[model samples]
Target: MKRRLVRKLLFGAAFICLLSTQAFAQDGYRMWLSYDLIENPDKLSEYREMINYVSIPLSSPTLEAAGEELTPGLSGLLGEDIATTNQMQNGTIVVGTPGTSDLIAGLSLDDELNQLGPEGYFIEHRVVDGNHLMIIASNEEIGVLYGVFAFLRQLQTLQDLEGLSLKSSPKVEFRVVNHWDNLDRLVERGYAGLSLWDWGSLPHYEDPRYVDYARINASVGINATAINNVNADPKILTDQFLTKVAALADVFRPYGIQTFLSVSFNSPVDIGGLETADPLNPDVADWWESKVDEIYEKIPDFGGFLVKADSEGQPGPHGYGRTHAEGANMLADALAPHDGIVFWRAFVYDPAQTDRFREAYDEFVPLDGQFADNVILQVKNGPIDFQPREPFSPLFGAMEETNTMIELQVTQEYFGFDLHLAYMGPLFTEALTSDTYAKGEGSTVARVVDGSLFGYEHTGMAGVINPGSDRNWTGHPFVQSSWYSFGRLAWDHTLTAEEIAEEWIQMTYSTDEEFIEPVKEMMMMSRDAGVNYRMPIGLTHLYAQGHHYGPAPWTADLPRPDWTAVYYHKADENGVGFDRTATGSNAVDQYQEPVASRFRDLNRISDDYLLWFHHVSWDYEMNTGRPLWNELVHKYYSGVEQVREMQNLWNRTEGLIGSQRFEEVKSLLEIQERDAIHWRNACILYFQSVNNLPIPNGYEAPDHTLDYYKALEHTKYVPDPWYN
Candidate 1:
């Protein structure tokens, strides 16, 4: 009898969603938080029966946000106005902490709640006064908000709720989004559009998009954000800009996102009017301490500073003959009073170093235990820049005595920007799953950053997510998948990329098996397809010098040798690839044990990293029994073929999704195919010039000469004004 009533209500809700669909077009603005009506009759019946009403006494801001989200979300899904009751009922969905509810307190959930920490929560079916109720219980208000999103996700994905008991917590303590947005409204390496933060209109006019940004982030368990470029302007720390930052903090507070800033290291000299910004100087330390106090007065919960000191012309203690730790520790001391932490980037490189891959590890490993407790060295996933394919950074588990964080680039800076479809879930997971062998074989990069390997005081995972003023947030619709995957994996590293893609597709588009399977498969193949045509088999940094939009393997003239493509892939007459073994630069010595030994050996190393660690001869036979030159041609051609397959798959999924977004993706795939062909032709032609080899029989010849490809101009590239 109960199931019959639920089925009737679900059908009514589906009718309402159908009507709404006709009125609105899919523009991808909702992303993965779309709360469409449930389609499956049995699953809808179960959800409707379980969540008849929501009981959330709005005692705190976070609880209020949870209630506001749950009320409307359930109404849309169940096709009825879910009652907001102050009192519990037979089918009540109670969301609260132990301190906020006497019922939850009396239940004696100390053992479970204690183990979950402050940010963890559990959804359990409870019997109170002989009434079965779904209780979303936690130790804090923020956890209740996370629980609400998780519950909605279950309904959206049509998970069975029979005897459901779900407990979840973030694997990493700080899951942060790092925005390379500058004060002038242009973003560095941003492909979507202009910066999201409208500096000209901020502090007085809060855009509705701010709330939506917080909602999207919180839905995936992201807890923090750094909202400026690492190449920062010192003016952002001025009193006028603090007011603007405080306004944003107010909007993000209820959603459990603490705001952070990317600060210039010379702020003491630039903003505070000091003669020098020396870390050890008493006056400089005092200036920073007072400045931090001023900031706390406006934004009490600020997450602290992200500094890009001593790299890429950014000012640091190096100018004053001081160590990196001294610079970071000084800032850590200033923010310690407010319980804040510092994210000091370890993306340093020197032209003097033989290999850029060894720079960060060499500079940082010696000073491992010197940093303060609140300081976390933010290391990029790969030692070289954000490459399409490269080995994991040797810095991951190297500094066992110091707190560390993994920094990932969600923006498609090196993978064709917003023009191509490249889902970065595979890229992110590949870096995380790498074996560091720090303590033993099981010491993965995920374990190191999560503080499980070394029991570090602080742990984090930061992603350079370049969402901008574009209507869809990210320019390409598929880039949202990488952002979504990053947040989900930060919450639970155990979840696979395939699982995340399936759920994201279901929530953002349709739950139809045909649509979900094909779209998910397309997303899974995107990262590899991008790597193949662009930089297959450990190739790195071969893009055009400034814009990095297209292939430029012949580029060797730059201010610095490390800035040129020839510095990375040394394609000479005899062979291609940079040798990083003991015979060459000895960069493999940075990794521990079996990893170092495996990379040093030609026979033992994986083919994926063959060229990265060794400069092999053109005639050297590969595992496929083909010569090195032939294998390179095969990979470059196959990459173009994979992209064509993606286009076909997307074309087959035409009517399954909304025509607006469907057409947008369809046209973008056409562009990707053209770009893939350009990459294949340019790279293969350039490499052939050195090897003096003919094109294999099966591959198509380049349409244009090598000179034509080199002279081809790319207009409107490089988002940052300074790059231009």
Candidate 2:
């Protein structure tokens, strides 16, 4: 059954009431798209004067979507129903492509439109033939739809529209969201509810929620999405599942989103009954070619494959002694025919390597130029797994000959899951704005992924996001901010984290300064707070085994050496950090000059990454003039305090934001405080045991002993193996 119908039947008339109250209730289901009536009479009057009628001179499905969204959205914000007109009027907001609209064609905007490419758009307030017209013009219908959303955003954020002139084009070509969802409805690392895709009912009963999903993504300029776990199951490629995927593609297509799939590299053997799945094998290549053809027949605008080959246990070309280039090129060849691209993940690691941080760089740097033009190596933001804090991946700018895309995890896999309000805007901007020093000082990671630094053919940014069956999409109300910020930054990297947060706060919640200022500060400080509590002072990977939530600093019983906490921390009597300088792993040398020199120099390095690049003694003096041990304790305690401050900040806005969401956030902040304390106590005690350091003179002693914290079961916070 369709989930929406099931919801209606189960709830009856109460569901209808819920929909009516949604705007005021702040259920979070509407995310930032909620269009509440403007309370300021003057602002509402101005908006009404500017947008009396929405005039779209086109008839395409995309242009129709623009009209559908604009008319109702304006009506809600202006507190009056907006009319649609076929003729040009003084108060009309005209939106369309030049070819579709004679009014747009007559504007002689050929030079301006030429620069917008396919997905770019412009919104201008101009006096055309003595009529004040708000013109939203683009080169294509989808771009017009984007412009419609952009125009609404100005009203939603309460921006002054007196002399508005805005033009935007995505810095990256492919802005995508990758859902690590499985066929059985279980989401890997997903704290939100079940997978959004109801495979059981799909290909027959379409869900209305799918349209909303596409709308939300399109609202933030996300143009593509991969619909399954990268640890792909071969059945997704079969005829039975292709039909279901096609149904989803149809829903996403009208919103300018192309659907991609995560393909198992062993599909030739697992599903096709072949002897081997080697990329070099003729039969294996032919099997992929046939499968590509079959998929195109189902989804003509399919965005192609996202492969996790040769990583973690997924099968790849390595079994046949073929390089990554060989494997990627083989699939790229099949996809290139249909203008599809291959997103080959460069998240590989070898157990034999002394440092896991150097594994991806070592493996892929040599074969950078060999991969096909259609293949993009999707590298993680950090070289290590998504730890709370780590240096930018050395691979970001190292592969000068490759087309690279940054893959950032929006789900809080290593950042306290759904419990902690760890906003990721700062985290994303930190990585993007980091100086790679590849082509000199201005060569940022953002430039590399956006195809400017290396001048590569393909460029993109993919977020590993969680939007599941939960009413709010993501479990924590704040997670929507990360997903929103990621899409905005992916569209244009120049936008600041603070700018996006303020916009999100104004749109999603209340626009009053009492609510916006404090809430924005909390979101901006959230990521740093998470890092301070869990892995402060460049410490990382101290989470419990398998589940990766809560602390387990002494855990060393894992099967692989690299899988244990001891491998990353290297805590001992002498000190408590892994050494990655010349004397140790030499990972700093991987970065270009100046950046390498700064990281290697103890005095020059930021204390934020002191322990990341060098192992310092407990008694060693820090930039704060305190011992390293004292500084460590200070950061851990400060993190818990920050959460408390966040709670206070949120409490001030009570009765300002709707009571429903205010209470929800209030309750989550309490849980977050408890979790923060747990992390602080467990981590500090465990490290103190190794260093034998006393708590700094002014600090309060730990509530529990090291053994007490260690003896606490994993279930004290979250259950092991998220599937349960």
Candidate 3:
């Protein structure tokens, strides 16, 4: 009889969801948090029966928020109102922190909860006196909040609730989202729209999107957010802005997201009216300490500060002849008193006689154990800015004694703004899964950042967020997958790209097999396609100067050679590709043992990284046994074919999803096809001009002249992002 009633309610929810399909179905404002009704009857029946009654008394704002989400998610899935009663009933779902409820404390789950840390939780099915119940217990209120979201995600993603045993702990200690938003509500490299923070009405009027942003992040186990751009302004450090930031802290605190800020390193001089902002100076240190104290007094739970010192023209202690460690440690000392950390970026570069790719490793490796315990060096995924395909930054395992955090760009600044549908999951997976060879063979980049390899004091992974004021959160609808993918991989790096893609697709779009299978294939292949057209065969940093939208392989006019395309491609009369071998930059020597030796050899390395470490002749043989020129031609043309294939595959989703989204994506596919052909033509024509070779037979010919591709104007492009 219980099974019958559960089945009836399960099917009823599906019926209601089908009827309410018009309820804001097209706009993607509600991201992966879309808890649509469960249509699968057998799985839904099991879940409905397991989640009948919920008992989570209001303990704190955090617990109240978690309990508030439970009823709506249950009602939306079961197609009926779930009652919250004082009395326990059959099939009750009890959720609470250990100290808040006697029923949970009696279970004595402290041992299990203690192992998972303060932010982890477990949901188990328990039986007492012939009554079966689902118990969600955690050691802290924040852990209970995470437990609630994880339980709801199972229903949202259509997972079976029978014999449900969910126990999860975030692998990385600090999973943060970094927003490149400015005080003027203008975002750099942001394609979605203007900034989400309304600075004009900030301290008083709060936006609803702020809470929703925290909700989506909490669902994915994200714990912190650096809410401003790293290229910060001194005005943001004033007391006026602290009150404005405190308002956002109030909204995010209940969701377990502690707010952080990007601070100007010269704040002592710029805001505090100091004569010198040297890290070693006593007056400078006192000013910073007082400012940090004031910040914590206003917002006690403030996470910390993210400083992009001495990178891309940002101010730093270098002006006063101080090392990066001295600068970082001084700020770390101030924040350490409040249990706060300082994320000092390792993206510094100069126009010295050195390879730009080897700069970060060179600067930070020697100062391995110099930083304070509370300081984490934030290194980009690649040594360079977020290129399409570059080797993992050698800084990962090089600094064993220093706490390191891997920083990733999810905003598609170089991958092509809203025009391209490139999923960043594969890129993130390739970097994380690469063998660092720090200690031995199994020492992956994941191990270094997760504090397992050298057992560091802190561990973190921060992604530069792609979100803006667009209705879909991210500009392109499919771009949301990258944001979701980053959060999942940060929580647990073992998750595969295929799993993340499937999970995101099932939540964002329809769960129909026909719709899922094809879209998943298209999503997984999107990254390689962009790489082929933009920067294939280990090529990096070949885009136009400012916007980075169009192809400009001939760009040689820039303030610095490292900022130009020719510096990366090295396309001269003799040959192409930068030589980073022992004969050249010797940057490959930074990696440990066999890993470095493998990259140094051409025959042993994969075709994906052939040109990265070595410069070969135009007639050199590749794995296909074809000459280098022939293979280069094929790879460039293959990129266009992939995009065309993606367009045809997307056409299959015409009737599966809403026409508004379907048509919007289809139009972007058209733009992508045009852009891919332009890239193939522009790059091949320029390389052919240098190699003095003809277009290989059976590939599309360039319609425009080489001079025409070079002459296209990109100097006046808007939004020059300070990628510090």
- For TM-score, the strongest prediction is 2
* lDDT, candidate 1, at 252: 89
Q: Determine which window of 10 residues in candidate 1 has minimal summed lDDT.
A: 3-12
lDDT measured at residue 368 in model 3 versus the true structure, 0 to 100: 97
Instruction: Kindly report which residue pairs in candidate 3 clash with one another.
Output: none
For each candidate, the alpha-carbon lDDT, in order, equals 0.87, 0.88, 0.85
Candidate 1 TM-score, C-alpha based: 0.96
- Please give the lDDT score for candidate 1: 0.87
TM-score of each: 0.96, 0.97, 0.95
User: How good is model 3 by TM-score?
Assistant: 0.95
After superposition, candidate 3 runs with Cα above 4 Å error: 1-23, 713-724
Worst 10 residues of 3 by lDDT: 715-724
The model with the greater TM-score, 1 or 2, is 2
Candidate 1: list runs displaced more than 4 Å: 1-25, 127-130, 713-722
lDDT of 1 by residue, 370-442 (tens): 9999999999999998899889999988999999999999988888888889988888899999999999999
lDDT of 3 by residue, 1-724 (tens): 3532433354345334433548664578778766677767877787777667888877777887687677777887777678775445677888887789877877778777877778888988777676677778888888888888888777767876667787888899999999989998778888888888988988676666776788889888899999998999888899999989988897788889999999998988998999899999999999989999999998999999999988888999788899999999999998998999999999999887468989999889999999999999999999889998888999999999999989998998987787789999999999999899989999999999999999989999999985888888888888899999999999999999998999998888877778888899999999999999878887777777778888888888677889888888787766778898889999999989798888899888777887788788888888899888888888889899999889988998889988888999999989888888888888899888899988878876788997887776364233444432
The digit string of per-residue lDDT tens for model 2 on 1-724 reads: 2643443243333323333545534788778888778766778888888878777864765776677678767877887888877667888888888899887887878887888989999989988877888889999999999999999999988888878998899999999999999999888998888999999999776676777788899999999999999999999999999999998897788789999999999999999999998898999999999999999999999999999988889888897899999999999999999999999999998888999988999999999799999999999999998888889999988999989999999998888777789999999999999999999999999999998988999999999997789888998889999999999999999999999999999888877888999999999999999999999888988888777877898989677888888888898888978898999999999999899999999999999888888888998899999899999999999999999999999999987867778998999999999988888999989888898878888877888788887886355365323534
**Looking at candidate 1, what is the lDDT of residue 574?**
91
